[model samples]
Structure formats: C-alpha cells, structure tokens
Target: MRDFNRYRHKGAFCLMKYAAEDGSEVEWIWNSRDGVTPFCVSNRTGDKMLQHVDWHLDRRIFDYQPMPCERIFVDLSPDRARQRAERTIEHYWNRDDCAHIRQLFGTKEKAIEGLLAESRVGEAPDLVEFGSLEPGAYRR
Candidate 1:
C-alpha cells in the first residue's frame, strides 16, 4: 500500500511518505528529555506521538517568517542530522542557558528532539491529536 501524511501549521507543512511497511502514524513528538532516550532505545513502543493541530509560532524565527509559530519537521539523513547538530551547537553557543543534551544525539531526530526540549517554554498544546502507525515502521 502507498500512504502520505502531512502536518500543516500556519506557515509550515511537514510531510511523511511511508509505505504500508512503514506503518500508519499521525504525529511524532517526544514530550520529555528523560523519555526521549527510553523512547529511542525502545523504538517508539510506548512513545508519545505528536498531536495533529496548528503549532504555535516560533517567536525566535517568526520575524523572518510570515507565520512565526510554525514548527517544521523534515526527515533527516545521516549527513543532514550531523549538519543539524553542528547548526544547533552554533545556535546555542552564545546562550549560557542552552542544554548540552541537544548535541548528544548522533542523529538529527535526537538533536531536534533536544532542541524541542530546550526551546519549549509552555506545556504541550492541546489542539492536537496523536495516533500510532496502523502497521508501524518500527518495533521496540
């Protein structure tokens, strides 16, 4: 089977292309730094999923964007993930309050997860819905 999923916000759209082999999932998000490692280690068996809804504006990058609160998630390759790690390090270097954990992961998913943890200021939004992949790509 063929499937496509998209997460659309005010200014961003994150799309996922998965075959039936990849499973059926609606959202992907990690709620806590402590849970991230376990979730990853466990391959999402009990991990929290991102809820489908309009994400809040990202105040930091919003000025540059027509919509300020959109969060975009793109699938990452090894190289891109490494590049993201480097970029995240640069972005946080001047901020003493930054978390060292962002750069700990070897992959972009991990690093991005770290970024989300560090940048989050409020509770996770309520206008969202999360569902496990029908078949799922991974098993814990």
Candidate 2:
C-alpha cells in the first residue's frame, strides 16, 4: 500500500491507479475541494464499467479509504488542486425550513468558519451546511 500521509494534505491533488481483480484499470482522482472521481478502463472487449464510487477521508487513519482494492500507483500534487480550488465557489446554507443560502465562500473551510461565526453571534442556526457550485451559478 502507498503511504497515504503524503497525499492527505489540504487542497492536494491525488491521482491513484488500480488494477481490478477482473483485469481492468481504474483511475481515481482525489481533490479536497472537488472530492473523488473514478474512471475505469476495461480490458475485455466491449465491457465498460463507469459509475460513481463513494469514498471518504478516514480521520482515524488519516488516509483516504476507497472500496476494497489494491492501489498500483499514487501521484500527489498540490499546484493544480490549489489553482482549481481558488476558482471554485461554494454556497453556505442554513438548515431551516426554507434552507436559506447565507453567503458564498471560496472553500468549504471558509464556509464552516462563516457559519461558526454567525452561530456565535446568534445570527445563524446550529444546523449549517455547504455545497460547491460553479462560479456565477448563484447569479442565474
């Protein structure tokens, strides 16, 4: 197994390759802001498997644990991840009857911070969450 510590940095970009038991190549890209996306290249002719795979950062182990599989290679880089994170926009929403959007943030951490600040001032409720969207999406 590759050392996951080197890849678990904030805003890091990690590209991991895997070989499935059925002789297929899988590529998984992990971005802190964008989350994980998996691409599968089938070796058998006319057999294609493309689907969304759920993965999460395991805080206890301080590593990302995907569905049980062996990883072939891991490439960790921060430059492109940081650049993309800067361009992405996030929405901070208060969990209430209407789920009102409070404000826009550049990152999830910023949205959490904003929510915490508002909660401290009694301006926002305790149930707050954030979601990412494209730039200028809120204007439409």
Candidate 3:
C-alpha cells in the first residue's frame, strides 16, 4: 500500500509526492523559476531522479491511486515499451569478408547499415548477416 498527494503552491506550481513501496518519500517537483524542466527527488540516497521527459514516458507516474490499495499496476505505452525492448535486444552485425570483424548496434537498421558500409564495392549483401542478441544470451 502507498500514499499519493498533489500539492500546489500559491497557484504557481504543482508537486506530486508519493510513498514508495520501500518506504522512501518520492516527489516530482517542477522548477517554476525556469518555467520548463521538471525533476524527481527521493529522500532515499542513490535513487535515480527522473527528468521531465523520463516522467512523461513512464505511465506509472500518472496511474497513482488516491486511496490506499493492495497494489498498483501500470503498463507502458506501446512506443515506450518498444523502446525498452530495443534497449535489451542487442543488434549484431557480421560479414563473411572478415572473419574477425563483428560489431554491435542498438537497432536492427543500424546493424544492417553497418554491415553494408563495411562491405567492399562489389561485395554481395548475402555475405553479411544481421541479428539481435537477447539479453544474457551469447554466441561463439
């Protein structure tokens, strides 16, 4: 169970505060002085402070329960979920032209582009293979 609240300051700014499951106090405060950026803070040291863009991308921030509940579950937006999946999936590129040459990219398109760029002028695309390595999965 967790508690959440929104506090307003003289009709100028708003801040959202919540108690984490781990008993830490978390707050998302906007910098009214700058009139732009918003950042997150937690009483617990070493906690990652999320920036405005990060907060917007996270669906959990907007799904807080006003009343105490057993648990709260929030699903990531389709675009955000896909971005997360891409992060964990490592794109790999290798060409038959060089047995010892292999490279890793963050996206499939980049992997293929890398392989094509490294190929000789007349080299066939069939000599190259682009694939993704699952998280924690390895190959020789």
Top candidate (lDDT)? 2
- Mind giving the per-residue lDDT tens digits that candidate 1 earns over 1-140? 31213223332221212112234544333221111111111123345343333334212221122122222222223334444556876676545575454445655566666655544223212111123222221111
In the range 19-48, model 3's lDDT, one tens digit per residue, is 344543444432211022223333335464
* Highest TM-score model number: 1
Worst 10 residues of 3 by lDDT: 122-131
Give the per-residue lDDT of model 2 (tens digit) for 1-140: 64445543432333333345444544453332222323443332336653323334322233443333322112222332333333432322434542333335544667555544433231111111112322321110
Instruction: Report residue 36 deviation for candidate 1 (angstroms).
Output: 14
Looking at model 2, report the run of 10 residues with the lowest lDDT sum: 122-131
Q: What RMSD, rounded to one decimal, does every model reach?
A: 17.6, 15.3, 19.8
Higher-lDDT candidate of 2 and 3: 2
State the C-alpha lDDT per candidate: 0.32, 0.33, 0.30
Local lDDT at 1 for model 2:
62
Model 1 scores worst on lDDT over the 10 consecutive residues at 32-41
